[model samples]
Target: MNKFGVSAQTLIAAAFGAAIMGSAFAVPKLLAPEAGAQPIAIQAPPGAPLSFADLIEKVEPAVVSVNVVSTQDLSELGDMDQFFEQFRGMPGLEDFFEQRREQQEQETPRTREARSLGSGFFISQDGLVVTNNHVVERATQIQIVMSDGREIDAELVGADPLTDLAVVRVKEPGPYPYVKFGSSKDIRKGDWVVALGNPFGLGGSASAGILSADGRELGAGSPYTDFLQIDAPINRGNSGGPTFDLKGNVIGVNSQILSPTGGSVGIGFAIPAELAKEVTDTLIQNGRVSRGWLGVQIGDLTPEFAEALGIEDVKGALIADVTTGSPAERAGLKRNDIILSVNGQKVTDSTSTTRLVAKLIANTKNKFDILRDGKPQSISVTVGERPADPNAISPVPGGANPAEPGAPSAVPGKMLPDFGVRLSPMDDATRIALGLRTGDTGLAITEVTKGGVFGEAGFEPGIIILDVNSRPVASVDAFERAIAEAKAANRSKVLLGLRVGQVTSYRTIDIPK
Candidate 1:
């Protein structure tokens, strides 16, 4: 009585059994028997069967309802209470304040009650659990409720927003059931899957679905999401729950969905279990994930740009800017270089490139294959640990200075046309006058037109350009060389490395060839 018709072997066995029993008790006790006139018992084949009940029972203990509560400060609550008290004289205001005061008093001890529900799966017996970062973000109190009516307080261990994964530790250590991560890469597109979570606070709920897609790009909003799409019924509260395969292995963590009504329309997204495993391991060890800094801004290679670069196919990402003194620069990456692969793995686009680099363990060495001037070249690069908030302003090599109003042109002999603005060589007197530091160098703007490209690019006449197309431009000839190379390669745009005040940064703009 399985879903399908009885197997041939089973039918043959039944025939044999019927032949041996004849007509006497063939129909009476064929499946089961006793002594004297006892019939033989039917035996099933030798392999283990796929049972959903067994898998669910085994993994249910690992899945938990994660509740987060945040509180407001006492002073803020008191201020609000007083403000409402002052409005008591107004009509209905007194009643409102009375009710508000009662509610405030009830919530006073806690100060605030910001409740959010998600799901998590235990990973270690000593109380380590994994869930989505959004689940417990900014939560002052986190509680994990087990299936057996047991609630344990959880503490934040670490989280990676890029991967949307987090690790938490329970207050009391105990032997806890845990689930293992499986190879999401081995899962086929139409594979059966299950999602376990507290959807809408409905605890320990399980929904069945099929794997709809993999390696899906959610968007650039999250630069690291290589989502696995499924038809599982996941919702807001399901954000951090485990998505399991038939074998009871965790394959993903439900993260997002594409729904117009905030309900499951058979479209849900999850962070793949592989990525989650890597992130959790790093966070557990270092308290934070350390990403590799490629020091390059990249964009998708266009068909025109691909043809210009003599590429048979437009499959690689185009390099827009290679930061000076960065790993990319030290590895000899340049603007207009097309990155095809990292460490021999193909990249689909710039986002994939970034994610792959970000996933690399910090301070690791890898090989990069890039296309330069239509020729493939491989370079060895040792990635550096990404600095926290790399955009923080620091002392630049030179100073930043804008010329005084009606000031005369300082370097008249060296000038270049930039978006109808004239840029001239930087001088020590101009730097001193504009409060520009000595470390700042390169061409400074001498003049600009109103509503010109220079203004659109946020450039004033006095700002200096340090590098063009990832090449240092100490003189006007170097600047021309960079521009000439870009034009010769038919690149649509080029990046300029500039120094302004204590800030050193880059900007990419179209090159009018």
Candidate 2:
């Protein structure tokens, strides 16, 4: 049973039945005025579209059907019911299914062929097409069917999985019909828009609806989300099809639909052309999209938190922690600093700040206005290239940690009863072997108790703790002092900067209750 108390199998059966018996679309007929002396034509509000035939005719030629053939391993397949779930044990089919299942079970490491259908559009005259990355991802063979009924083999030029956009090309000499991407900024809610795609394998289907909303994030992974929402009836086969404005310009790419019935429920999502253009342009030039990274952890400022920070307006991204040796730290950005603007544009939230920062070119200097200690401060920071995997932490090169200048006490190591770790001062010989500079301050973690918080937090031996809550700690006394200060200040967690071999990073740990 489905969550709505209907049989899930019943819905699937209904959909398959519709597919077999569905009829083609027909244009609506205009009703004649009933015996009136004066005749009036269809009227719409000013600047609204009353008709779509002209717009559809001008751009329909640019649309194409994307079909892919892929292979699936038999090991991935399960029992017989999986194959017959769609058939649902109908009359006179049980024995046939049983025989087929028995024959299939005799084979070892078998394979099967799968075919998928999707929609795409021509972005350039020389057979350059744009579609969703998922349509052609892992596809062994792809065929593009033009509106003229010509099927052409296409090659993948580039694909960006982060934005779900891809580019393909066919090396043909003749020019092809194409569509131009228009600015999504100009489109607004209640504006008339049209979606053209191969819905349900029906070629060149068109649906009309208004822009229901914009900047909708439907949790389609990746932080580059800024989906345009529309009431157009897009379906499974409509992925990567273009949604056009009244002037026949492509403003969005229909990507997803929100429906429990496996059909359009008047809620469909499209990748905004503005964001799509950026990703496709990068894919065209670099074959992949590269974004700038700030290496800072930021959070949205709640009203209560803002009031405590003495800010009248509860806006902007609050910096919770900055990575050690990162561009933000090198630029003097500190924890508790509020990011107000980037490149003179106001940042409404943490996500906006990330989007703005990512648009910046790596190694380019950008201006940022921040609120530090209740005062406005301006600073210039050079952006850095984002790592391939932002969540991974690499071990620092051995002997690269910096050591303190002072001499160690008689004993080098001491046990922390509360934190459940053995901390030790960095001796010169050990520091030299570890490649530490003379100015680095921190005690080395000799051991972390097996069941301790640090162990569960992924901390291992050989890493040096350089600072606690932004305060340098070269000895046990200093470490204890910093922890005391953090607790006294009523902070729930303390940020720690650690030197793992040559790499430097920051970690936040909760204060023990």
Candidate 3:
């Protein structure tokens, strides 16, 4: 087979727009199937047509192309030096810097209006619309262009960034045609699904493919993602659109695709209907979502871990720890207890458990089934409302130092290699450059072992270790003491507060073997 194709891997940006420029090549139309190649023939239970003409005709009316105009800084005269720094010894260094110097003659900050494209559909007869949060997030002005060429202004109902779901309302009062969600649980593997979206700003485009695997976790950016994998031809502008079942019910909302050349290679992902419905319903009601929290850290019960715990079957989520004063602690849920179900629903794994608990109302009592010491037990937990931003520390008026009352002592000058990380004391100049204020004492990561646990867990040089297990560690001795305590207690993971520049976050590292 003579194959000619480009490598494609593109994760759609959080904010999509036409301002992101690229060259487009017109694809040549094929006369027929080439040299022994055949067209794909698919059907629904052996009775549907190969083409989805009738289905598309019915659903296309509700589809729309969402355009958003936002104003932001495009470039700045001060950035010229940094931009030219990359081409330090390139062939056109002189020409590039000369042109940039000419442009710097004006010496002005560059700001411009940017346009982005994505697809969406009407979900209610009263003008309620559904789309991706990334599509309309931070949008200054939003315009919805219908399939029949009617442009309508829309207002943001609300958006949940954690779930990547959003809702908007149109100003024009009407009984607009909308799509309904079908049971995603009923959709099976290999079932025919249709995707409708404005791919690359082409309004009301549709592609068909079989359902791939479901319940995929994209890991970092999407910690709570349980995506429905599809083989549809979803592109950049397809975000916030709908994927439909044979009976014309929306099964999923297209959000991401797995590609290398910015084009679909038949591996696309969608937010499952159940999750989307849950998020949208909350957004419509409260104009916000409050996820229920149990305040317990958990991990999957793998077979090896289960056997180590002397359990017979590899099931349930292993409770790692319970937060103080949290709902889980108040409900008497102890560490090492395996959560088997939520409200009688089976907890397949830790991720599903998190998703299930998030759907429950705050301050509501939910039944949790657990395994404790080889016996099954049930407990009723009154879940608490999860905080909107966990990383956000409420600022005190006239910034008070939360550090200890005593004047800071000098830091030790020794380095460590026990945790696969070498620490160095941050000097006054380094501390000032890293944006650390008074009373801030963070140990700089002078070195990271690439093959060790620190690097494997994404730790790199230039990150400052601020604390260990919520204990502020200003010296190497403090850090070593924390690690020694955890190791003595036979703990596998030790949590650390890390400061990368001005932002601080938590990361867990596995104890080196």
Top candidate on lDDT is 2
lDDT of 1: 0.77
- How many collisions per candidate? 11, 6, 7
RMSD of 2: 13.7
C-alpha lDDT of residue 37 in model 2:
43
lDDT of 2 by residue, 1-513 (tens): 844444878777766666776645332333554664454455777787657898998999999999888787766337666876666667768778766777777778877888998999999888888999988887778888888888999888889787889988875654999999998889889989999998989978999999999988655275787889999889999999999999999999888889999999999999999888878888888888788888877877655455433357658887765665678878989766789999999998888888899889999999999987678989999989888765453212332444432333235588876777888877555545444444556788888897666776788777778777656788989988888877887766676767665445667666666
Which ranges of candidate 1 are over 4 A from the true structure?
1-54, 71-113, 313-315, 330-332, 343-348, 375-380, 390-513
Q: Write the per-residue lDDT of candidate 1 for residues 94-140, one digit (tens) a residue.
A: 88777877777667464556788899999888889999898888889
lDDT of 3 by residue, 431-508 (tens): 555444546566878677766778778887778877765556788888888878767867676666676654455566
lDDT at position 133, candidate 2: 93
Candidate 2 global TM-score? 0.62
